[model samples]
Target: MSMEHHPHDVFFRSFFSHPDTMQALLQLLRYKQMVWQKDDGPLTPILPILFYHGPDGRISERFSQLFHPETPEHLRPQQVEFQAILYNLSSVHKDRLTAEKNLEFQAALLSLKYARDNMDLMIDELYRLARTGGTVFLSSKRFALVKLYLLHASSLTYDEIEQKIHTRITDPVIREDIMPSTAQMLKQEGRQEGRQEGRLETVHETVVRMLAEDIALDVIARVTGMTIEQIEAIRQQNDQTDQNQS
Candidate 1:
C-alpha cells in the first residue's frame, strides 16, 4: 500500500489490538513528533485517542503502529518502550499527579478527540479530572475551551479530517492557541458564511438556468436541495428580472 494508506492501516490495527498490551512505545514516537515536542521527561499517564466503531470497541494486532514516528523505525522501538510507561499509568489516580502532569494527560486526551466520534466518556473524565485543579497544557493556551468543542464535536468526520491534516489543525492545543485570535475567529466565521451564501447562489442560478430551458420545477428543487415552491418563486422573480433587463 501507499504511504498515505499506511497511517489508516495503523488506525485499523489500533482498533483490533489489546487495550493494555498494545505497544504504547510506538505512540510516543508520533506524539513526540507532533504533540509532545516540548517535553522529553519521564513518562506520565495519558488517555490516548482511541478509534473504533460503536461503543463496544475492539482489539487487534494493528495497534502497535497507530502513532507515526518522527525518527526512523530503528529508534521507534525504544520510543515505544517510553510510551508504554504512560499507558501503564492508565489505572493510576488522576488526582495523584502534579499539576503539570495532569495537564499533560488532559491535553493528550483532548488530542484523541480527533480519533473518535463520540467523546462523552472522555469529556466526563476530563471534567472529573479537572475538578482536582490540575493543569493541562491546553489550559495555558487561548480558546482552549473552544478547542474542546471542536475536538469532541461528533458532527465532523475523523476520516476526512485525517486526510486534511496538512491543511487543517489536528493538534488540539495548536488549534486552541490559534482559535483565540479575534482576527482568526472572525475570518473563519466570515469564510463559513461566504460558503453558505455561495451555495445558495449556485442553487438559485441553477434554478434560473433550468427554468429558462423549461425544465420541471421539481427537478430543480431535487437537484438544489430546495423546495418546489421555492423554485417556482424564484422562477417568477427571474421572469420579472428578465423583463426589466430587456
Candidate 2:
C-alpha cells in the first residue's frame, strides 16, 4: 500500500472484514502451508502493511488508536480491531530510510520521498540503481514504467527521459525491452476508456428513455442503480434539452 496520506484504520479493517476475502486468503495460505502437515488444521496469521505518504500530520499505527476517545471504552469491544503496520513515508527522512539492507528498497523509498518536487533526483537515483543492478527501484528493463509515471506526475517529456536512459544504457536488448511499454500503455488506456464511454452512453440513453416514460425518480434510482439525485439531475438535463428544442 504505497499511500499519499495516512489512511483511516477502518480503511484496512474494512478489507479484512469481508468474509470472502479472508476465506480466499486463508484457503490460499492453507494450500501453501510453510510447515508440513497431514491435513491443514488452522489458518496462519495475516499481517497487512500500509506504506503511507499522505499529508496528514498524525494517524495511529494500532487499530484501536483510530477510534474516537469520547466513545465509551466498554462499547469499543464490539468494534472490529486489527493491527496493520503503517509506514508514513512523508514523515520518514531519506537518510534514515535504511530499508533493511536492501539497496532496491532504499532506492525506491528515496525516489518516493522526492518524487513530487524533485523528479530529477528520482531519475538520477533510478539511473544509478539501473547501472549497478543494485536496486529494483527501477529495473533496467522496466524504465518505461517510471517514465509513464513521470509524464503524469511531472513536466518532463517522454523524449527527455528516453534520452536520459539512452545516455546511460547502451545495450540493445534492454532498449528493445523498454520500447513497447508506451504503446502497450496507450492500447490499454484506449480500450479502458472506450469501454467506460460506451457504458456511460448506454446508461444515459436508458435514463432518457425512462424519463420519457415518466418514471418516478425513486423507481428509476432503484431499477437503474443510480442515486435519486443523479436520476433527478439527468431528468433536469433532459427537460432543459426539450425546452431548447421547443
Candidate 3:
C-alpha cells in the first residue's frame, strides 16, 4: 500500500481508541482487583492465568500488523482484517471463564454493567496476573500500559499486579532505541518557552528519516504523534534522502 493511504495509518484508529472502549478496558481491569480483595489483600501464585477481553477483529489485526509486521507483506492485510475480533476478545466475557457468569454481555453497555457487578473477580484476576510468572496478560493493548497507570492511580499495591503478570519491565533498550529531541528543543519545552515553529520542521525531518529505515511504527509513533501519512510525507519531502538511504 502507498504511504498516502496505508490502511492502518492512524493511531486513533486503534481498537482501544474510543472512549467507551477505553472504559470497557478499565472495567475489565477491575476483575483483576476483585480477585485479590477476596483473598483479604494478599496474592499468591495459582494457575497460569490468561485474561482475554473483547475479541474484536480490528484490534487483533492491528496488534498483529503493528507488532509482527515482518511476517510477510502479502499477509500484512490479514492483520487489518481481524481488528473487530481483537476488540471483541479484549472486552466482555464470552467463552472465557470468569468468577461471575451473570456479568456476561454481547455488547459494550451490558459488558460495563456486568463488569461492575463482578468487580471483585476482576480485582482478584489482576492480583493473580501480577503475582504469577506464566500469567498471560493478553489484551488488545499492552498489559503494562494499564498496570503502570493503576500503580499510582489507586491505593492498592499495583506493583504486586506487575509481579504476578510478570510485567516488571526491564526494557532499558526501549529508552536507548528511541530518539531524543535536540538539546535546544528539549530546553524550550522544559523552560516553558513553548513550541517554536522551526523546531517542528526539524523534528519532522528527523522522524521521516527514522521511518524510511523501516523503524517500528510503535517507536516512531511514540516519538512523533504524526500520522503515518505525515511521516511518509516527510519521505516525499526529501526525495534525495529517500533515494540515498533505506
Candidate 4:
C-alpha cells in the first residue's frame, strides 16, 4: 500500500503474487464473508484500492487487462481472480481534478501527479485546496496525511514543505500541531535523518528561533534542507507575525 507505485504492476496481485499473500487476502475475505452472512448480507463486497503514481506504465482496473488479448476464450476468464479500483494518479490533470469535491482525494491525486515533477506546483495546489475548502478541510486528518505524503514523496525537504504551508495555513491546529506532529512521527519512524532533540519542541518555534538569530538564508536552507526561497519567505512571515512579540 505504501509505495512509489511502480512495482504495483498488477495491483495487490503484484506484491500479493506470493501464495502466502493470496492466502492471507483470502482469509480476510473469508472472515468478511462470515461477518456478512451473520450480521448483514453477502451483498456487501470488499474492493481493494490501488493508488498508483508512477511516471510511465499502462494502468487498468482489471489484472486481466495487462495480459495479451488474443488468447482463447476459456483461458481469459480466470486471468485475474479479483480486481482493484486503480487511482491512476499520474495521468490526471489538475484542471480535470478540480471537479473532485473531496479535498482528501483531490490531495492524493495532485500530490501523486506531481511527486516527481513539480514541488512548487504541488505546494500551490495544496494551498489553493485549503483556501477554497476552508479550515475544517485544512485541519482534517486527511490533509495532514496528504501533507506528510508531499513532504516525503517530493525532493522538497521538511522545512521547504513547511514553508509552503506554515505561514499560509493560518489554522493553529495545522501549524502548531499537525505540522510538527508529522515531523515527530517521521523522526520516530527513522525516516528523518539528524533528528535529535533533548526535549521535543515544536519545529515552528525552531524555525522562528533560527530566523531571529539572523542566520543566513542559505545557511538555514543547508541546515534544515529547506530551499533559500523557503527560508526568505519564513523570514518575511516571521517579521510580520505577532509571534515574535509573544
TM-score of each: 0.25, 0.44, 0.24, 0.48
Q: List ranges where model 4 is wrong by over 4 Å.
A: 1-51, 64-80, 83-85, 159-185, 188-246
Error of 3 at 32 (Å): 44
- C-alpha RMSD of candidate 1: 21.0
What's model 1's lDDT at 219?
34
Error of 4 at 185 (Å): 4.6
Residue ranges of candidate 2 with Cα displaced over 4 Å: 1-46, 95-107, 134-246
Measured by TM-score, the strongest candidate is 4
Residue 121 C-alpha lDDT in model 4: 76
Q: What local lDDT score does residue 207 receive in model 1, on the 0 to 100 scale?
A: 62
Clashes of each: 10, 3, 53, 0
lDDT of 1: 0.39
What TM-score quantifies how close candidate 1 is to the native fold?
0.25
Q: Which ten contiguous residues of candidate 1 have the minimum total lDDT?
A: 1-10
Q: In model 4, what is the error at residue 108, expressed in angstroms?
A: 2.7
Those runs of model 1 whose alpha carbons end farther than 4 Å from true positions after fitting are 1-100, 113-115, 134-139, 142-149, 152-191, 195-246
Clashing pairs in model 2? 4-53, 4-54, 5-54
Look at candidate 1 and tell me the lDDT of residue 128.
43
Winner by lDDT between candidate 3 and candidate 2? 2
